[model samples]
Target: MKPQLLFSLLLASSLPAADAPVQIGSRRELFADSFLIESFSGTHLQLQTPRDEGVAFKFDQPWEGLFSGYATLVTLGDGRLRAYYRGKAVANKDGSEEELTCVAESADGRTWTKPELGIYEVIGTRKNNVVLMKAHTATHNFSPFRDQRPGVPEGERFKAFGGTMEGGGLTAWKSPDGLRWEKLAPEPVITKAMVPYKYMFDSQNVPFWSAAEGKYVAYYRVFEGGIRRIVRSESSDFRTWSAPVLMEYRHPSMQAPIEHLYTNQTHPYFRAPHLYVSIAARFMPGRRVLTDEQAAAIKVNPNYFKDTSDAIFMTTRPVEGTAHSGVYDRTFLEGFIRGGIGAQNWVSRTNYPALNVVPTGPHEMSVFVNQDYAQPTAHMRRYSLRTDGFASLHCSYAGGHAITKPVVFAGRELSLNFSTSAAGGVKVGFEDVDGKPVPGFGLEDCVMQIGNELDRKVAWKSGTDVSKLAGKPLRLRISMKDADVFSFQFMP
Candidate 1:
């Protein structure tokens, strides 16, 4: 043997062993990050932005206007949508009596109307649609979600976290249904005394029951070294929480940049529970674009135009056994959603996204962003994308391929959510851990996959049933030409 060959063998023997096969049962894996992939030859994973679909719901009601923002949408148990948002017309101090939490009802998300809840008399009569008011600072940025934790009491089926740093810390609330709510505790649950951060809870602090972590997770705002960042805490029950720790940032290939993340809208994707997607607002302080004359022309508040903001997308996956790594993956450095084509679109605290991205159709998902901020026309607009379409493994017309790390999955068929041009297609092949192709599952046996589908099974010459490979280690090699693959799963 050549001396170079002998030296290469010695180097390989000193290296660490490869990672164990990932155990993904039936979970739908998305290309939002590079976790599942090992190598790429000609293809690269490209992050996708949601399509702007105009206004989904307008906050033009008498109780909601100008300053109305921090919207959170929840799909109730009965399939109807219950949207909650802060109702304030005047710019006032935190927890002002004028600040109210209002709800809008929608059978289908296309049309929304305020239901007469008759719960409180905030601005005069009790005939208004206010769900919470006159409760101190709790209603200032009250964010509630339907608790889906198994064995959770019916009375506490709904839970919320809302309070300013001055109001105490993070207060808790519970509701049997979604409308009527009462304080879970008279005092704030996570107080400033419990954490080192002095400035926090001023923005919308989100707390929810995470089925993925099997615990309650809270993603709240904090200012460290003059820059706004996020900290995380977890709880077995909704009452007691672990110590808050700052989350770490990671990238597949590049260094993650630090920016002012105003509100970290971190929540599990409805379809993929294990993956948490954060549609955070990137606050660019002092990054003014609108001149005083242009701001006045659009009727935007003079003070608000001094700075501008837009929404960004991120993802976080729980580290196994460790519970929380607090590491968020910054797959794409570019902005997920950009400022619109107008002067009014540039303003402080504008373009902040709501909490959850819910399904509007069988193959479609919608995310809402607060737009036209600090102006009379301020309203929540909707953006839609194909289900599990946050990012995709894309290939140009020249064609390319990507190989996944060794994985052991459970199911009978490999279902793919992909799109391709009429002349372009994708092919799949299975390889053993040693890099040899499996006889019947090689790329040569695959039928070309074309067209768009939310879930199309990968078919080989032997058909789509992959149950025989269940629980065994195998790698997937996907080759595509002018195609995009959003997500994939092993379905029963």
Candidate 2:
């Protein structure tokens, strides 16, 4: 059945007398644009789920035990992947001597092995995977990122931010490789005095060079109305950051129930670097899932089993001149990764996500999570998702259609990452900003797009080339049946 089409879709049903086209600049944009999706008739935008790959690495070292936090993973140039997290056996106030930053490596993200760096001796052994220790309390949550900014010093190729305001705000560190570290500044780079908030910089404060904005971006935890929330700050250099502003959620999210976000695993998506994705842990304080008996069986910390939490996803396309204006789309308010099977999975802060999501294979990306925290079974588990598969414009067998706001572009071909059932298919049509279908590019001209593909070019009887439409404001009308369009990009 042909899906119904809407004309000049607006933020409302009644269109402005003569609405101006949404002037999408000549950069590659993604379907992640929630604002573009003005309306969907019988269609819905769906969030994709990550498949669990069990334990990627375990915190079984004698020195390491329950209470591991701030797991960070990075893919290296040497064809290896590195995992970093604090190794602690028992609960200690944030920066106790018990906390040691540990390292684990993997050739493939699946099987991980900890290499004995033997750099710092903790737990009476110089033969463990301890990377940073006794370096003040900063190692308690040392969050690191590969500094890919242009002209970054060889020794400073790796950068990190750690420590709380009580431990002296956040201190900067540099590493030639990710293993060894040195302080960028003797004093903390960002302090409580810099921001108006009193209790900021408490969790895994993450900072990375955003190639899109050409600045250093950091997402950290801050208290608001006594509830945990996320804030954003920026810097041209890693040493100094802009004042932290509470991140605001857009339309649907602003309307949804709020929860405490523990650690925001916010990072630039590898494919769409401009779109920052956050797989943040939604902490449900005092929301107990395990009874005392169940908690005792798992040997969870007495204080830990009282609450439970899981991961949620959000995205933002940061613009340069926004101070507390960046919008986060919590399109999916439900848990991205739910606690499965066991009561142990629901214990306090067990499913706190790591800092970054790394690509493990050509078609797949993996996110590491700190699971079973403060329990004897505490370890890191991996969740896998197809490339560009975080969210999709989805429809069921009943089928539906969506019309995008007018956008400008510069490309010869339109490519989509999508999947469908045998009977499901997708068809796309182009229209001028005025809501008039382009000649030879109407829905009737489209050849039904079927099958699953990472990059499939949309075509019509007029052929796929649309270079002539470059820079002209246009809209896309997509109709689908039992299919999901994960993402789309126009390529020159």
Question: Which candidate has the highest lDDT of all?
Answer: 1
TM-score of each: 0.95, 0.93
Q: After superposing candidate 2 on the true structure, give the runs of residues whose Cα lies further than 4 Å from its correct spot.
A: 1-33, 320-325
| lDDT at 480, model 2 | 98
- lDDT for each residue of candidate 2 in 1-492, tens digit (9 for 90 to 100): 100111112112443333556555544455553756867898887877899899888899988888887888887888688989998887778888888889999988998888978787765778889888877778888999999999998999999998887887889999999889989999988888876665877788888989988889888887887888877788988987776666767655358566798888888887778788888999989887788899899888898888889999888876533333345787778889998788889898888888778888988888888898888888999999988777788899999999988777777888888899999999999898767998888888888999999889999998898788778878899999999998887887
The sequence of per-residue lDDT tens digits that candidate 1 reaches over residues 149-223 is 999999999999988888888889999998889999888899998767768888888988888778899998888
The count of residue-pair clashes in candidate 1 stands at 0
Per-model RMSD to reference: 6.4, 6.2
Local distance difference test scores for all models: 0.87, 0.82
